[model samples]
Target: MARRTTDINDIAFGVIRVRMRLHFMLTPKGDRQAVKYFVIGHPRNGTTTLHKLFVANGLNSFHDSRDWQTGRHDAFSDFGQLRPVAGYDRTYPNARFILNFRPLRHYLNSIATHHQKVFSVQNFINEAYRRAEYFAWALDYFKGRDDFIAVNIEAPGAVRAVADFWGFAVKEPPEGLINNVSTRPKLEQNSANIETALAALDLVEEAGRGCLVSRLNGARQTALLAARDTIRCVQ
Candidate 1:
């Protein structure tokens, strides 16, 4: 018998069409209010959890999905690895930004592990490090801006903080992390390489201070401590 085959392009096109229909259906009929929140964060950083919380509270929120046609969502989260495009703030003048922060080591580990599992190879280390730097850059670039609030999703009270920032009430935050990839067992194998690459990047020390850096090892701990001190000295 001939081997069965699947047309990947056809499947991709079908998915796109489905997404388009979904977006159209979710779009508001009348001229609704402008977007209230824009979550500018790296991938796998609890954006999904946050989006769920928002929706459960009756807010229309979407994660990692852009809707250029409708522009009717109450909140938007997860733009993947790339930093916010130029004039993002200008485009959404009234929209506030929720900047999510994650530790460099853990962030890279999760992404690398996920890539390894999905692609059957491990080559996302550089891309992960680049994303980490992008997060750091976003923090510095948006510093002191009243419209932007930086929060580490791992922290306890993060959901409440975000709600307070947005002038709303969330009776309960999500219990645990969401969209998290299983990477703990693989961290030992990947941490050293991730640490080495991150150390070389010109990351903003101040931004590093606010992250939830995991206690991976002495070297990683020392680097985080140094970065934290740099943030203090500048302040």
Candidate 2:
């Protein structure tokens, strides 16, 4: 028979899943609470802004490429909160996840643009290979399970198309924003690019059954503020 087990905290370039295994609820004494949270997505999609918003709301959040490399952050290192809890999900299990989404060509362009700025003009194949490698890493992390929540700050149709193409797309954009439009950035979503992104998302989601907290890309500020409020509410 196939093994029927799920990893506690799994993450990659795409899906993130945390399994909540503890029945005991713990609090950080009095008014303060240590609720762990992570932001999962492409580099430029407002991860920095969200990190600031969480801090502004008095919630503890961390972000950095090194954070992942060193496994200093929960999403990378511990799988879950370093708290004493059984199973991956139950460990620092109270934390939530924020997954940002951007248009395909736009996302690709942003990465390519940044790569070029950092190094030199990159060839299309080089960019694609880098992106594919990132996606593969993400897929490795979210390889089996759900119990993690995701928030998308991109267009749903565009997101779906991209995820379908790339093999990721964990959760369908939430219900309310299904028809919502985002103004964040103007990018021509070519059919081919969309397909690639979608494929990536699908693969990630399959490995991990995560939910989608979709938001209109146009209302980035609103989304940031709302995320801040959410942290505050829990705090």
Candidate 3:
């Protein structure tokens, strides 16, 4: 003989099921806007700086390394990563891409300086030289795609060019390019050594041949001259 009574467990389970259904129904619409664009570039490039600019302009941009590490797929309007994440293009077919670069010499200098403690000098040199090949690969992989834009962050009016590409006016252009290693101490020796090594390998010329840097038109061309001038001033 058992006492007949309402089961509290049954009532709680029913409430949870109803809430779960509501959550799933409301999620897809929000996820649709996630990862609208990817800033595909290497470390010591301007990815972080550009991300700051995008946020300043009221766009929700995130650095994706943390997301990748935590196995989270949360959405954001923009995503910046040090290197291309495999399968992202196939997964996000409609997402746009920004190919960002800097002069190879300067890029190497920045990398060697910033990571001097993290990597051996020989390892640093090897890694810096490899970046050119990586850049070339990325350029060829995305060639002829109207959804991508290559930008040299050191260029003048780069922020303007980015805004134009997106078809949105910025509230204000970024103050200046950020995260330079020029002022970092103990870099002078590394810079000289890296320059000599690059010249010996002709890496700079090789990088220049990459379509991303070689093919520039309209505003990008103007920006190239500005970039050269900026580099000259810095040196």
Candidate 4:
């Protein structure tokens, strides 16, 4: 009994030490030693869904929902502008960029819904353009990075898109997308913006040597799991 107790204590101590090490590695020492990952995408397109996922998993993930609703200038800027402020380069010394991609039409509809919810239809057209610009900037930024993983969902033949999107990335796709009722396609500009944003992430993933995880629906649980896995893997 004494020997078994000792063994159990040793195992507990080992687990605690591992957890401590993980916590320490996650926090950057200084600005120069920091690493930040930006989840850049136009309004909607599951950015919030991803944000919720990360938070749910107890990772240091930021989800500024106001960036989409209010005319808040923070989320209005291009990826380059938001990149430094978002501190993707400073938050983690070693980070992976998880880029989400969707169809153009479906993306636009999301934008419209966002606008309606916020009652900003008065200047809707201009806001849409601004959002598109941001997405373009994000794509350019993602493409420039070598450490990004681009996950494209709209692309057909991507049976595992939804699962991958949820951060599970199983070899086989789960059942659902086919039987699920499809929503209306997004607007042209919104679609374009999503395409541009995804393209940028693809470039970053290619350069970063990171793996892509895809899924059909961007759920909170998936984001949290992905975030936890990402932080663990990166750290």
**Which is the leading candidate under lDDT?**
1
Candidate 1 C-alpha lDDT tens digits along 204-229: 24234445232322245555444433
Candidate 3 per-residue lDDT over residues 1-41, each given as its tens digit: 11123344336635654554454344433344354666766
Candidate 1 lDDT score at position 185 = 54
Q: What ranges in model 2 sit over 4 Å off?
A: 1-34, 68-90, 117-147, 155-235
- Backbone clash count for every predicted candidate, in the order shown: 0, 34, 0, 31
Model 1 scores a TM of: 0.60
After superposition, the stretches of candidate 4 with alpha carbons farther than 4 Å from their true spots are: 1-37, 48-86, 117-125, 156-235
RMSD of each: 10.4, 15.2, 17.6, 20.1
lDDT of 2 by residue, 1-235 (tens): 1111222212332132221212123322222223445554556554554454444444444655432321223332122222222222344445444435443344455554444322212233233333333333333334332423333345335334322422333423233233222334433343344334435444323212221221212234344434433321111
lDDT of 4 at 153: 37
Q: Looking at model 4, report the run of 10 residues with the lowest lDDT sum.
A: 69-78
Off by over 4 Å in 3: 1-35, 68-86, 118-125, 171-177, 180-183, 203-235
lDDT of 3 at 187: 55
Error (Å) of candidate 3 at residue 44 is 2.1
